[model samples]
Structures are given as structure tokens and as C-alpha cells.
Target: MTTGTSKAGMMMELSHDSTLRELTTDQGVLRYHEAGDGQPLLMLHGSGPGVTGWRNFRGNLARFSEHFRCLVLEFPGFGVSDPADGHPMATATDAVGRFLDGLGLHQVDVIGNSMGGFVGTRFALDNPDRVRRLVTIGGMGRNFYSPGPGEGINLLMEFTENPTRERLVQWLYSMVYDPAMVTEELIEERWAQATEPDTLAAARRMYGKAAFAATAAAAARSEEAPLWAMLHGLRAKTLITWGRDDRVSPVDMSIVPMRTIPDVELHLFPNCGHWVMIEQKAAWESTVLAFLTRKDAA
Candidate 1:
């Protein structure tokens, strides 16, 4: 076996206590971290080079797991999941659909951050019956703009052997209110994931081509009119939460979606950034729990 596989095996062994499992889907066998028991809640992570479900939802897992079956999916080419043969973004929506089918979950509360948010919205639109409720955090793809130089540079450095920790911290700090929250352990974990031999090349390819291309294509198709129209058509109760200080997908972009959806509610947390769940875990959990447990939502 390759060094990457050996390292992954070790990581899996260490994470066994977390109830992590490998689930086969159409795209590939995905490594997922699952917890809790009740109504199903599917969590999708952002599309950062080395992003995973754990990194996106780590801080809020305990609270959410208490009330819902929380399944954090590691997308193909990210975390421990092997790369898909086709274009990753093109096949992702179908992969998610197959995953839900494989699990025999008719409907689920879908929560996604960043790129996952984009996919969640698309999935809801494509398979309304499969999504009971939709929640997106700092979502992208609604608008089409090139990733700034800083973002491009960060994506490139993530694949390097010695990814600059300081740069990574800076990038994360820009995504949250308190830079101090970017702990050493968190940084190290992110570094390790980014540098993992199995995923590094795939990550670079995603950043360079599939990610932005897919986002642009999706945005062009949705535009403002179509996206709003789709939001209006959604039967599921929707909750839109955004960070007041979100520099990535600004709070302004969320306003139209909140107003367009008939049964939608919006929450903008102050002193927060793109990663609101991590930046304001308590408030985020309470808000989500209250929304999901509402009479109309149930």
C-alpha cells in the first residue's frame, strides 16, 4: 500500500472512537463521521482545498447530535474519501442523492456550509421530496466572481509540504471574529489534511478547475431571477443564517433569498464571520434547534 493509504489507516484507527465509517456511494467510498439518533440531519462541508465535514461542523456537533442524527460527509477528494474519476463537482449532487437512497432516508434536514451550501440548494431544487428543510451558511455560487489572489494563493500553498501555518491562520482569522479561536490543534489538523498525500493533487485540481468552473456555471444558470424563483417554489421551511461580518459570502447576498422564500426566516449573528457555527457555537445551535423543532417545520 502507498504511504497515503498507510497514514489514512492510522488516522482511521485513531478516530474509531468517533464512530467514523466508510460508506460506498456511486462516486467512491466516502469516509463519514456520524453521531446522534433521531430525525436525520445531513451536514455538508465547505469546498476549501482540504475541507471536510469535521472541520466545518466540529464545534457544533455535540449540541446538534443531541436532537438529531448528525451525519457529517467527507466529499470525494476530501478527507479520507478517494477521488472520483469524473469531474468532482459534476458528480457530487448525484453522489449525495445516491447516498441518501443507500441509507433509505426519504427526507432529511440538509445543512451545508460554503460549497456544500451551493450543492444543498441544488439538491433541494432537484429533489424536493428528499430535503425536509434547508439551511445554508456562508453559501457560495449564488454570485459568480473570481476568487481573489489571497484565496488562490492559499489554495496553492495548502498542497505544499510546509504550508505556512501563519498564512493558514490569517486565512481562517479572516473568516471569523476572533483570530484566537484558530487554535494550534485546529491549525495542525488542517495542515495535516491539506498535506495528506492521497488528497493533495486532487485538492489542487479542484481549486484550479472544477470548483470555480462549477460555481460560475451554477451561478450563470441560477442568476438572480431563477434562483429567487426556485426559492419561492421550495415547499420546505427554510432558515437562512449568516454572519454579520462574513467577508466571503456577505450578509447582503442572503437578504434576497430570505425574502423570496415564503416560509423562510433569517438570522444574522453579530461579531461573527463566515464560519458562524464555529465562531458562535451556542447561538448557532440554539437558533438551529429552535428552527428545526418549530411546529411548522415538524
Candidate 2:
């Protein structure tokens, strides 16, 4: 492991157990963390302030890695990855495809959370042959209710509009079922990342994109549709997981995919919030492993 100096004068492991590395993709530099070995399992993180794949999946990575070759990416415009020059979602989706192509990965089982879920949904829709098993947690673009933004989006807007550690902490608190999970270290780490000059600038651009989306949504006819998803087109064996108390993406939203997708299973974690993998680490990882490894799945 390579040792690096920190602002606090402590030596930190830059690569941290050989799990961290960078690869060049057609989209540019792609950073990621990986471990274990078997069928490729790609995990995508949410779009919360300062969100990183490591931060989002650190708790569950070890267990999941034990079962499969785990790869978690830092999406473009997030973390250390290069910023996007176009639509963030499309940019991310393209980067994902390019990343896999660069690695010569033929097929992978994908698990996406929140914004990552949105990316995964589009990826599966566009590149169905590239994915073998699919899992989406609290994914966006749903119709369990009206898809106009919710508490999580509102909180994110507040953070981007105001840009404060206090607001970021509050946002994190609202994302989880238990306040105990909002530890000081976690808060500090997220705050540190959110405060980076370039990252903060990227966030402002994202906020503008979100605002434009909201305006377009307001002008659209309410009769247009109750949802926006391509669930019917996805051919991968899928497991849609949600937390019962999740306000970000409601539990009932699972029904949309379940009814539309050809092959899908729904699981809800009672008393949990948007961060199901974090709060229900054991159950979440085990359930996902079983689904991906099932003889009938891939």
C-alpha cells in the first residue's frame, strides 16, 4: 500500500488495501474500488451531497465482495471522477458503458442506489445485453405517487442553494431511518467533500439542471402519465429493494417495476429509510447475492 500525507500530518493509505485504482475510459479517467473475484458485480452510489461509491457501499462491500467480484465507481461529476460536459445522467451512463468496455468486461450484475438506480435503469434499457442481473434501490423516475421531487430532492435543493454543513448534515439525517447512523465522522467526511471548490461548482450546475427539470415538469400536462420508466424493456432478472419508511423513493414504488418488468422481485425493509444497504447490511447483501447467483437468474 502506498502511504500519503494528510492535512492532519497523519500518514494515510492512498490506495487503501489495493482496493482503490483508476482506469482510463473513453470518457476520460474513471476511479473505482474493487475486491474479491467471480462474476462482475457493479455497485453505483446515490447523488447525495459529497456521495462516493466507497462512502455509500463501504459497510456492505466486504460481504458482497466475498461472494462476487465487486466494482464500485465514482461517477463523473462526483467524487474524484472527471466532471461531465453534457447531461449528468447520460454522461454517467456513457462513462459506465465505456468503463466496462475499457476493462473488456463482457457482462455484469448491476446494483444501483438512488441516482445510481436512475443510471442503471437507463443503462439496462439501452444496453440490456451488457447486464445479466439488475437491482435498483430507491430509484428515481417512478410513479408510486406523483414523480415531482420529494423530501430528499427538497433537501438537496436546499444544500445546493444554500451550501452549508448544517444543511448537509440535516440532509443526511433525513436520508436514514436512525439518527445514530449520522455519525460525526460521516458528517465531517461528507462535508469535507462537499466543500471542495470544484465539487461545489459542479453541484451548482447540477442544481440548475434539476431546476430546469422541475420547471419543465410543471409546464407538462398532468394527464400525460403517472410515471416515466422503461421497466418493460429490461430483460435482466431483477430485484427491486426498498425501505418501508423511505421517503426518497416510497416502498409502493416497487409495485411499478414489479408490474411492468417481465421478471422482477420486490423486497422491502421495515423501519428502514433510503439507505437500505447501510441499515440492513446483512439482509440486503445476502438477498442480493442470492438473487445474482440463482441458477435461473443469469
TM per candidate: 0.80, 0.88
Off by over 4 Å in 2: 1-17, 209-227
| Top candidate, metric TM-score | 2
- State candidate 2's TM-score: 0.88
For model 1, residues 7-98, the per-residue Cα lDDT tens digits are: 33534433434657787765568777776678999998876545788778876766676678888877787756667755556456666887
Please write out the lDDT profile of model 2 over residues 87-107, one tens digit for every residue. 466678888888888889988
Which residue pairs clash in candidate 1? none
RMSD of each: 7.1, 5.4
- Candidate 1 has its poorest 10 consecutive residues by lDDT at 1-10
